[model samples]
Target: MLNKLTDAQVKSATAEGQKQRKIADGGGLTLVIRSGSKTWWYRYRFAGKQKTYSIGTYPEVSLKEARAQRDEARRLLSENKDPVMARRTKGIRQQHDAENTFKAVAEDWLQNQETELAAETIRITRRRLENWVYPKLGTLPLTEIDPPAVLKVLRRIEDQGKHETAHRIRQRISQVYRFAISEGRAQWDPAGNLSGVLKTTPTQNRAAIIKPDELAGLLRAIDGYAGQPATCAALQLSPLVFLRPGELRMATWEEIDLDNWMWVVPGRRMKGTKKAKRAGQVPDHKIPLPRQAIEILQPLKQLTGHRDLVFESIKPGRPISDNTINSALRTMGYDSSRMVSHGFRSTASTLLHEMGWQPEIIELQLAHKQRNDVAAVYNRSARIQERTKMMQQWADYLDSLKQGADVVAINRR
Candidate 1:
């Protein structure tokens, strides 16, 4: 019988040329040393066939442990069991366990989410999971996560006085569970049962001045805002177009058509349904600029016409910071509780609705979705003539309000 190989001998062994070499220890145990790497294996004859069982790599699996494993394999073989088959079965179970872990399944779901969600949204979602969800339930199997386990994580957020965030986290967890179920990795959504379990916080609408007089005051303040010229233009044009703050700040010159009195915001720039994103097609939102809006933008073209972005910041290439408009509003004595940048949309929605305009037409102007799929398609081009007139009328109304004209509130018909 050959003597057992020593650790020193295994470490000293190196492959000559390109060929790997193996040294045999007694009792079918072998040491493979090739290219400065060492591994242990067991060679045996079982059921009239030769079989090899990988023990583990050297240093990671010490010689004593490998010998113990080899002895155990020999014991199994004496009982007519195949050690190689046993090791393969054990390895498969470990792989299955890893795949079924909550972290593993959630990662898969997040990868699928990348195609539908915006990059910023994806980043926030991943951060939330890494911070809160993963630390608690990540190592557990997907199927093992129950409502109580989920509630424990949410309660921690609630404890921090973030009631709204707790609700949002629950929704995100529910989405992950749904994804797991669809992939056949889980059977039930524990988070679905958590409805109303968390404390409810009142919804806070964005601060906006709906009254014509107050809105007029806001317009005057914006006009007199002694800020950056680009910021002043943004504040002045915000009411005319009433776009989302991001859309307004990130506006490019190519999207504008001065002669046609139109601004075509691409679907990617505007917020839309996940279905729209998944289809890789979003209808461009067309904003028909009234004469007043054109007058304001034409002069801005003289200053920023050479650049790609209409609202370039002091930094040369980036758009104005999101805080610019809100900060401008603050300087004008309107705090967040009284008014905000997003308030422009609310201001437009309320006043336009009060002006006896058709709700659908107003919604179309606001780039809001229609009630159904058919209405959404038809309304795209349905009221262009009316909308053209309405846009001009709205602008003229703002002008009247700014001039302190006795603007009578039009009742809804």
Candidate 2:
């Protein structure tokens, strides 16, 4: 029995400041109301409950548009569902998606990335996520993330003067976002648009090898180091074998083939390369075992014999601290730039080259692949005899250098 809503009547009611009119045609409905303003709404009974939902302002929605919206709402209601509830459920879902936080995605990214990344890499990635990224943005979902939030996390680390860590964290976050997209967990990469948004800084390279002249000083210094004997031997051998710090620290008695004069670095312990998957053999490295090197190991065997590593730490089975080697170097008057424990490789490479040994032999001794192609395997024997002689001669050369004797190269070719 409601009258049709004419524009003139609608305007006249609004002007008179009357409570707005109600106009209904068939099942369609429109509400005109004023509370310091005129507006429209649709009212109906659903499941025996009355519900009134706004259809926007009267003039903006108009009579025709209001009727259309009313019909759509009723059609949805006829399906034994409440339109308001349906709309509420859709909104809840969108909210959930937008709330997918940084911490949750990062954990998922770390687990799925287990296969693609190296063990050491995985360890570091997880540590960074746990220690730095998680506490900051771990709860925020990616879709709702923006640059300012990301910059805030980065700037916190930067404020601590860990610019390098900050840069790496940003890079790690980007990688996580990429992984999320690939796994169908995310629809877009929020990290993609970040450019010039963060400051770029160069990180200093700290790897160093002691100079040839300084080897004598280092040897003499090791003799004086007040550290544990096992620490001393490991420090001395670091340069001689030039093994990776982890490889050196984790040396197990089971892996040593002293009879063959080879230390077979098992694949699990080695860094990735074609040879890493298969067992890689480090030749006896023919250490004539300097009296100093031998002396340090002899007594230490009785101490760490029960443990796996030749230089097991006081922490029972744990390997020595990553800083143990470098710290020993620093105590010996070498800074990171002067000499790093890893710099032994460069030291050996340079000294062997200076001693007039063939590049092939030195490179082979170094276990460096001459080419990247799979077909380019190292010729295991190109320098077997030469390396044996070179290592002994190199030991003697180090002795002479330590004694401040004029070093003369012996060509054992």
Candidate 3:
């Protein structure tokens, strides 16, 4: 048997030239001395073959501890077990244990979702989890989270009059549980059975004035309003474009190709279909600018041309608040129940359809999804020339209404 190594001898051990040197500490344990490091290794013959097992590094695992680990490995070897395999198994178990917590699994799920979700969406999701889910269920094991535990958290949100937010939290929890299931951290989604359990808020359509006379009065109010020039310009352009409030508010100067009379909203900014989001293929939406729209944008461009955003806020580089348009409408005496910023879309859609514009063209111009997949594809390529004509005509029609043209009331469908 080889003699055991001493602490002084181990401290003095060094690699010779480019080769590593090993000093045996009897049995199956050996001290490997490298150029800049020392490690403890246990070697033995098992099942008619020699096997080596790493005990640990020296200084960290002293000589006494290394020998103790060697003895444990030999014990495992005598029981027909491979110590390396056992160590690996233990490591995997520990890793699973660490990752099996609800918060740990939820974080992993959120990380995976970052690639698929928008930055703003991801931020909101993280905030929701941090504020609501994490505090209650985060520390619990994935398997330990149940419906009641989740309901308790959701009920708090419900009590706060945030029924929609409570519903969203439930859905997020369900997604987290599903992710955990896929990762082998959970068995089932506890939030899956939560459907119809929470109180449902009645759907309310955005209020809009579809009457020609009322719409004309609203238009005159916007025209006469004395506000920030940019705000006034946004109010003027809103009825012309009829874009979603968020989409219009976040419009950047780069998105507009003024010379070409087009605004190409990138796929990232557009509200895509669920299928499109899943497939990671959000198509760009194009808006053909009318002459009236161009005229409105021209003056605003001169005012805020140096910035990225067309409707910039007081804070440089930031877009106006989402409530800016609605607040402006309210300032013009249109209450929330009477006219919202989103009411522009409904007003435009109603009037265009009443004007006998093709339903497909009007819907496409409104950036709504076509139910038929092939039709959706076709609509994207088709009717651009017609849409351009239709938009200019629509702008002309609005101008006529603003100028007190004859009001023809078409029956509401």
Alpha-carbon deviation at 226 in model 1, angstroms: 2.3
Candidate 2 is scored at a TM of 0.68
Best by TM-score: 1
lDDT of 2 by residue, 1-413 (tens): 44366667666564354555454444546655555556666677887989986767867777677677777787888898787787789788777665556777787777776765666787987898788878877877777677777778888888888877887888888888887788676777665665456666666654665465667777778667788766877886776667778878887766654445555566566556333454343222222333434444556667876678788877878778888989988877888878787788888787788778888777766666546423224354344566667666776677777788655565666
Find the 10 residues in a row with the least total lDDT in model 3: 404-413
TM-score of each model, in listed order: 0.74, 0.68, 0.69
Q: To one decimal, what is the Cα RMSD in angstroms of model 2 from the true structure?
A: 9.0
- Scored by CA lDDT, what does every candidate get? 0.85, 0.69, 0.85
Query: Model 1 segments beyond 4 Å from truth?
Result: 1-95, 277-281, 406-413
Clashing pairs in 1: none
How many clashing residue pairs appear in each of the predictions shown? 0, 6, 0
Clashing residue pairs in candidate 2 (N, C-alpha, C atoms within 3 angstroms) = 100-141, 101-139, 101-140, 101-141, 103-138, 261-284
Candidate 3 colliding pairs, count: 0
Model 1 scores a TM of 0.74
Candidate 2 achieves a global lDDT of 0.69
Rate residue 155 of model 1 by lDDT. 96
